[model samples]
Target: MNIIVISSPQQELNEASIIGALFEHGLEVFHLRKPTYSIYDTEALIQAIEPKFRDRVVLHHHYALAEKYNLRGIHFTGHYVKSHSDQLTNWYDKAKQQAMTVSGSKHQLKELETLEVPYNYVFLSPVFDSISKAGYKSNFADLKSIEKYKSATQLIALGGISLDKIDQVKRMGFDGAAVLGTVWEKPAQAIAVFMELKAAWEKKDQIF
Candidate 1:
C-alpha cells in the first residue's frame, strides 16, 4: 500500500530539512498543501527541497509550480473541483500533457459517479474521522461498500490514518492511505512516525 504524506498546512521548524530527511528515509510521495501561501512562497518552499527529490512532491495549490519544479503531480481538493468544475477537465488534460500524476479529493461517494477524469488516485476522506481536525468524522458507515468503486480509480483513505489504523484501513479495501495528523501532530518525530506507518502498511500481508 502506498503511504502518501500530506504536508502540514502551516510551516514547521526545520521543515525543508525534515522533508529532505523524509525522502531519504524512503517516503515515496509528499503532498505540499499550504492554502494561504502565495505562489512565490510556495515556489521558495519547493526550491528549499533538494533538487532531485522535488519530483516526488505534489502540489495542492499553485499547481503550475508542479510543472515549474518538475514535481510529481497536482492535487484537486473537493472544494476546488466544486468551485471550478468547468476548468477541471482542462487542468486534467494539461496535467496529462506534462506527464504528471493527477489526484482528486472527494468527501462523498456520490461524487465519484460524476467524475469526468480518472484520477491516478482519489482521496476518500474522513474515513475514520480526522485526527488532524477535531469533529471531522468518517462519513461512511460501512467502508467495505467502497470496494465497488475500486475499478473506477485508486481510492486512498484520508483522515485519521494513524499507526494503529492501518489494519482497519486495509480491511476496508482502500488502495492506500493519505496521512496528515499522524506525523504533523508531533512534528519532531515525523520521520519516526512515518517509518512506523510504512512498516505497518508493508507488513499488513504478514500480520493479517
Candidate 2:
C-alpha cells in the first residue's frame, strides 16, 4: 500500500526545512495543500525545497506552479471537479502524455461507484474520525463493509489516518492511505511518525 502524506493546511514553523527532511527520508508524494496561502508565499516555500526532490511534490493549489517546477502531480478537490468540469476533460489527455499523476477528491462512495474521470488516484475521506479537524468524524457506518470500487483509478483512504490505522485502511479495500494530523499534530515528530507509518504501510503486503 502507498503512504501519501498531505501538507498541513495551516503553516508550520520551519515548515520548508521539515518538508526537505521528509523528501530526503524517502517520502514519495507530498501534497502541498495550503488553502489560504498566497501565490508568493507558496512559491517561496517551493523555492526552499531542494530542486531534485521537488518532482515528488504535488500541488493542490496554485497549479500554475507546475508550469514553473517539475512537480509530481496535481490534485482536484471535489469543489474543483464540480466547478472546472471542462478543464478536467481537456487536461487529462495532456496530463497522461506527460506522465503526471493527476488525482481528485470525493466524499462519497457513490461518486467512485460511477464511471468518474480517470484520476491516477482519488481521495475518499473521513475513513476514520479526523484528528486535524475537530468533530470531523468518519462518514461511513462500517468501513470494513466498503467494497473496492471497480475502476482504473486507485482509491486512497483519507482523514484520521495514522500508523496503527493503516491496517484497517488496507483491509477496507483502499489502494492507499493519506495522512495529515498524525504527522502535523506534532510537527517536531513529523519525520519520526512518518517513518513508522511508512514501515507499517509497506508491511501490509505481507498480510492478506
Best by the TM-score measure: 1
Give me the runs in candidate 1 sitting further than 4 Å from their true place: none
| Candidate 1 C-alpha lDDT tens digits along 5-48 | 99999988999998999999999999999998999999999999
Alpha-carbon deviation at 160 in model 2, angstroms: 0.6
State the lDDT at 75 in candidate 2.
87
Error of 2 at 123 (Å): 0.5
How many clashes (backbone atoms < 3 Å, residues ≥3 apart in a chain or on different chains) does model 1 have?
A: 0
Candidate 1: C-alpha RMSD after superposition: 1.5
TM-score of 2: 0.92
Candidate 2 wrongly placed segments (more than 4 Å): 204-208
Clash number for model 2? 0
Candidate 1 weakest lDDT stretch, 10 residues: 141-150
Q: What is candidate 2's CA lDDT for residue 108?
A: 77
Per-residue lDDT, model 1, residue 187, is 89
